[model samples]
Target: MEGWLGLLLLLVHNAAAAKMKIVEEPNSFGLNNPFLSHTNKLQPRTTPSPPSGPSHLFRLAGKCFSLVESTYKYEFCPFHNITQHEQTYRWNAYSGILGIWQEWEIENNTFTGMWMREGDACGAKNRQTKVLLVCGSSNKLEAVSEPSTCVYSMTFKTPLVCHPHSLLVYPTLNERLRRRWDEIEQSLSDELITEQGYRKLLREIFQEANYLKSTESKSEEKENQKGSKRFETLEQCSVANNELSEELKRLKSILDKNGISYKNASDKTVDHLVPSNPNAARAEERFHLRGDTGDRDDH
Candidate 1:
């Protein structure tokens, strides 16, 4: 009986060990750090305490991508009124080959973020604060912005000046709260933080992510609007070139009557053989009509 009981204990130990997995991740600097995956997924079991999340001064901001070429653009709208060409920008934050509009957070050297759970309940919706980690910070953090993936993130070359003051995954803090939760998991007699802590952190982040910061972006919209305008100017330049070429031809006929050639940039003596009209201040031909490369799009 003693040997049989010992065998049962060994089986249980092996089963428990298989439940928790540490995944090794390769980062930007090519270092591998281990991340622990939660064995049991937690669900939000209660309403937000403050209902409306807390107000924060700073906001989390990063790029959006449908497909990242130059500027991360995800949508294309061919509205002739909004400007000329089709405008490409980030489209859906819920579903794309790449992920969606992720709500990412940052603080100190630690980082954490979440992704949408793949299933029917969350299968369609972009992972809101309820479940999504855009990116995080930690001394041993890895950054990967990859091909065919919409990774919203921020990287601090140095550690954050101040540590984040919040519960990790109250609602769900990624790395920002991972360290705290790691400690809490040990303290709650092997359970992670209480339900109260998770909700508290969730509420805090919901409010925090929604706030407008002093470092807000008003220019990004203006800039995109400006980018669409250049395509319009390219059309105008084409018209201007045609008008100049026509007038130059008329002037050349007048000069030919007096047997003169005005073809070179450095030669200006042909002025003496021009017509006497007051407008004989001769309309100029574009001697250097350059080819249109879409350099105007840079502005």
Candidate 2:
């Protein structure tokens, strides 16, 4: 009887040990996780790893770094997706459409750098985080442009995720984007307008008073910067005038010595050379003579 009881006790102990659940909870894939305290299988431990190396956050992608090198032509476009179910990251770059060189500020792995749209002014306006997705028939989602432009962005698991709403589809989109960029560069390399087109443009530009004034203002600004007329000091100007006067006197003396009739500059009159009936000249004379001393002869 005692031996039978001992045998039954041992059997019960073996069964209990075999079926015992020591750890409270585990991952769905059957990996034992120490951070999890729940008995539920769906929940997994998310405690920060020691000496985090991208897995806790992420790592830099070298290929993405090159995409943002040109700030002028591209803008910030982030592609968020998953890798092998364990990794999820964002590939960031410029939108590449209607952006400029200065728009790209290379920070992060920078698959895509800062966004520079055509109208983006300063950091305030130009930073656009475009959604990355594949565009095809399987899924159809509303475009962010229709209801809200730049109001929000999406993080996709794959190109297939955003396929419905996305204009570009992952790797295919990359080639399309590159081809489009190449075409644009080729087009811009050539003179955009024909001679006739340029002539028409010039005529139009000159005909508009506002445009002409703007151009004049720009030209004047350039002149002011590069070839501005510097003011001479009073002493320098006075000395120059004195030198010119002496030079004139010497020239007159030379002419006299040569037996040529010479008149002093002030004594010479330009009235006889005037065209007598020039209205434009009269208007110019009136404008210039407003503050002129009457005795001073202008030759």
Candidate 3:
């Protein structure tokens, strides 16, 4: 029995030594080890990487900002949704989702704004907001405006949106020139000036800086042309004034002949008879002066 016990103890010691050796041995395969295969099989829980670009507004993700304009309060959540609440005594006066996060607006390879879309409906289309991200010391919602029905624009300021040399005290030379060009284009579009006038203005812009100051250097012919333009303008004004006076006098004579007081007439009716523009007034005066004789002559 003692011999059997010694043999059993030796067997147990050998098994224990083998187990210890296996545990102490370094895993040469590292992750590929059969023992660690289960660990490798388990996929890692991936955390989303931060948004990449000069404007790192991803730091503001999941954060919210608010602004109040008049009776309405606007709430903006980065990488989320925007909402508007009407101020009232009740807990829920009027609440609406303005927009949902769509994508980042990129300009010049930099993130400049956030576009949110597909919100509450307005007419046939849905509401949307474009939040312009500007640099500031702290994150804030500056203002919210609905430039059109169901379309919203927001000015949002955050330090995260700031980039190297983003702000400027004044516009660049190119910007100023572009603005002037736009103004000239607008003038032409508004019919405030003719095509010929636009070209003249353009030429004046490109002329020497002292061109306006050197009026004395102009030729006599050019001076005479300028005087003619002025005289023509004055003559037109005088003609329009005379026509208006004659029309008024004629109306007054007729009213007196009928023994009707001018004061009793409706001002609107009088204004209707007297056209707003000189051309229209002239046409109206001619029509009245010719009367039935003109119609018979036309036939």
Best candidate (score: TM-score): 3
Q: For every model shown, what is its TM-score relative to the native structure?
A: 0.19, 0.18, 0.37
Tens digits of per-residue lDDT for model 2, 1-299:
99999999999999999998778543332222345322232221121112111121122111121121212211122222101011112122122122221221111212222222232232454323333333344322223231245323322222233323222112222354445434333322332222333333333332231112234346755886784334368887777667557645553443343334423345532222222344435333322322111111223
Q: Write the per-residue lDDT of candidate 1 for residues 79-126, one digit (tens) a residue.
A: 000001112322211212222222333332223432211111334432
lDDT of every model, 2 decimals: 0.32, 0.31, 0.57
TM-score: which is higher, 2 or 3? 3
Cα-based lDDT at residue 142, candidate 1: 27
Q: How accurate is candidate 3 locally (lDDT)?
A: 0.57
Q: Model 2's lDDT to the true fold? A: 0.31
Q: Please list the residue runs of candidate 2 whose C-alpha ends up more than 4 Å from where it truly belongs after superposition.
A: 1-91, 96-232, 235-273, 276-299
Task: Identify the candidate with maximal lDDT.
Answer: 3
- Residues 79-111 of candidate 3 have per-residue lDDT tens digits of 777888665544325567788776545333234
Name the TM-score of candidate 1. Answer: 0.19
How far in Å is the alpha carbon of 126 misplaced in model 1? Answer: 11
